[model samples]
Target: MKALILAGGKGTRLWPLSRELMPKQFVRFIDGESLFQKTVKRALLFSRPEELFVVTNRDYRFRVLDDLRELDVEVPTGNVLLEPVGRNTLPAIFWGMKTIQEMFGDSVVAVLPSDHLIDANEDYLTAFKRAERLAKNYLVAFGIKPTRPHTGYGYIKPGEAIEGGYRVEEFREKPDIETAKRYVEANYLWNSGMFALDTELFIDEVKRHAPEVYAAFENASTVGEAYVEVPDVSIDYGLMEKTEEAAVVPLNVYWNDLGSFDAIYDALEKDGNGNAIKVRGKNAYHLGIRSRDNLIMTERLTATVGVEDLIIIDTGDALLIARRGEGQRVREVYRQLKERNDERVLVHRTAYRPWGSYTVLEENDRYKIKRLTVLPGKKLSLQMHYHRSEHWVVVRGTARVAVGDREILLRPGESTFIPAGVRHRLENPGRIVLEVIETQIGEYLGEDDIVRFEDDFGREGDG
Candidate 1:
């Protein structure tokens, strides 16, 4: 058996904390371990490191690698499939299944989404084992028995009883509150988006039900080529709902997709006043005098006087305040910001890179300041800014600086200058992490001002 983890969702509903660059899966919301890491651990319970696979976009490549590194789990780098562009779940899963077929030949593959919160208890293992047993002939989906009337998740109605599972009667869309209540009353399961797929069975189903997607990958030489021709469709619409071989396995385990702030509120521990508070960074605290049944997440001192059933998220850069039931509308704010090309929709104060990370201290029309941290033995791409001249001051450790034709080493309190159009690179030569305060001044200080001549992490064309 093999495992394929999907980690490419944007998580727009969790904005102000989750961004286009750092989605919720990579965010360390529990015990300093990302949801992606937790999902990897769950996959390891059934499959070995070499048999595990991950399908994600190029934007999350380093993040996935860094998370796996921190977990001390060694998954073969080749098993990490990087999609050139996202084409929804169907294409992603098909790509993984095709690869599995080519490598292992008709294996049972567990498909798990990386951002979900699921309890890996005895029930979870048993449910997946049952799904695998049915996967030889059925494209099996693990359906969570509805705990309540949830309007957020799609519902699956089971038909005839089968061994360890049931044949699917219908796949219903997300419903209104009244419809959701009916679904719960009828014993419908919440679509968990987890699956046990036999590569051969899944491939045959794709060919039978979704010939367009099947043909797209059939002729394409590379994943990127296939993505260009593939339509954006989910597995539910493209294959599962249309296939006769669909089956649903009841997974009676604790499962939460954490799709919205309301879900987050439900998952968190509440105080006596029924307020859930999560404070990040140093000296951050929340004081709620008369607040009850509220979720407050902050990075600084916050005081709420008389709020109830509210969601307050403060991330130093942007803050979101909303009613508890209105969590799904947060995606509207993300969509609006995206329409305006707002940077806040894409990144926070700090941004991560393969080499290390950089935090924006301040920025204006003609200048910007950033604190850059480079990991030991890592170097920035050999690049030049056409419009911006940069001044770097070593704040900690040692910096190996290359300017135009000269290379020099700078220690703490030392500084260097690189004029516009002058190619330069920063590196950490010592064992300690290097920290530098960089100031850029020019007519245009956008990130796209870069022109890379060489790169270490295959990011030569990127700005």
Candidate 2:
């Protein structure tokens, strides 16, 4: 069996903590390992590293590489597929399945989302094996019995039991609270968004059900060409609901999509007072004073006063305070921010690049200051700013600097100046991390004001 992991979720509801560039899958919420890492580990249980494949956004190339390095496992280089743009689950799944078939003809593949949290104990393993067995004749969707009226997830009505699972009767969208309650009362299962299927058979079913989607990719040689014609539809709408082969396996294990703050709270270990707190470091803490059943995830010492069933998430730059039941509405905050062209919607105060990362120390109308960290042997683009002049002060290790025609090396406490429109590059030639403080003075300072003469990451246009 092979593994096809979809890792292209934007994680809008998990905002402030999960930004556009740094989504939930790459984040280390519980242990030091991320959800993506956990998913990879889970896949390793049933498939070899060479048989595991990943589908994620093209911009997340470095992030995927970074996490793979963190896992300390050497997988095949050709297995990670990067989608230029996300067209929802159907396209990602289709492309992944197609790639898998090309690599290993006629296969039983388990489709898993990289962002979900699942306890892969005995129950999970049993259900997974059953799903795999059923996949020879069915496009198996692993379903969790609804613990409550969860409006965040779609409800799947299970029909008669087959060999090891049930045929799917109906697929329901996220409903109102009353509707969700009714479905839960009727023993409806929450759609787990995980599946197992035979690659060729699944494609045949997809072609039979969603011809436009099939038309989009069935003839294309590359995913890049295929995605251009792909419709923006989810797997439920494009294939699952339409396919007669759709089946469900009851998975009685701990599972959560972590789609909302309330889900995060539920996934967390609660204290004696029913409060769930996630602190970034020792200096930051949840000092609860008569606060019960509150979920606090912050980077500072946060104290609640007489609050109950509240969700407070502070990420230094933004704070979200909502009722535990109202976590689904948090996506509205992200939508509003995006509509208003707020930078917070796109990035945090610190931004990560392919080479390393940089944190905005201070910014205003006239100038902006940033602390840039360049990884060992990594270099920034040989580029120049159109509207800004830069001053770089090396603070750690050694920096190989290139300003205009001159190539110079700088040590700690050393500095260099580059006037506007002068080609400059920063590289770390040492074995340690090189830290530098960069101050930019300009009439207009924007991240897009770069003209790259050379780049190592094959990047162009705005960063």
The reply for model 1, stretches above 4 Å from the true place, is: none
RMSD of 2: 1.7
Which candidate gets the maximum TM-score versus the true structure? 1
Give TM per candidate: 0.98, 0.96
Candidate 2: lDDT over CA atoms? Answer: 0.90
Residue 328 of model 2: what lDDT?
Answer: 84
What residue pairs clash in candidate 2, if any at all? none
lDDT of 2 by residue, 298-351 (tens): 988998989999989898778999999999888999999999988888777778
Q: Show the lowest summed lDDT stretch of 10 residues, model 2.
A: 454-463
lDDT value, candidate 1, whole model: 0.94
> How high is the CA lDDT of each candidate model?
0.94, 0.90
Alpha carbon deviation, residue 280, candidate 2 (Å): 1.6
Q: Which candidate number would show the highest lDDT if scored against the true structure?
A: 1
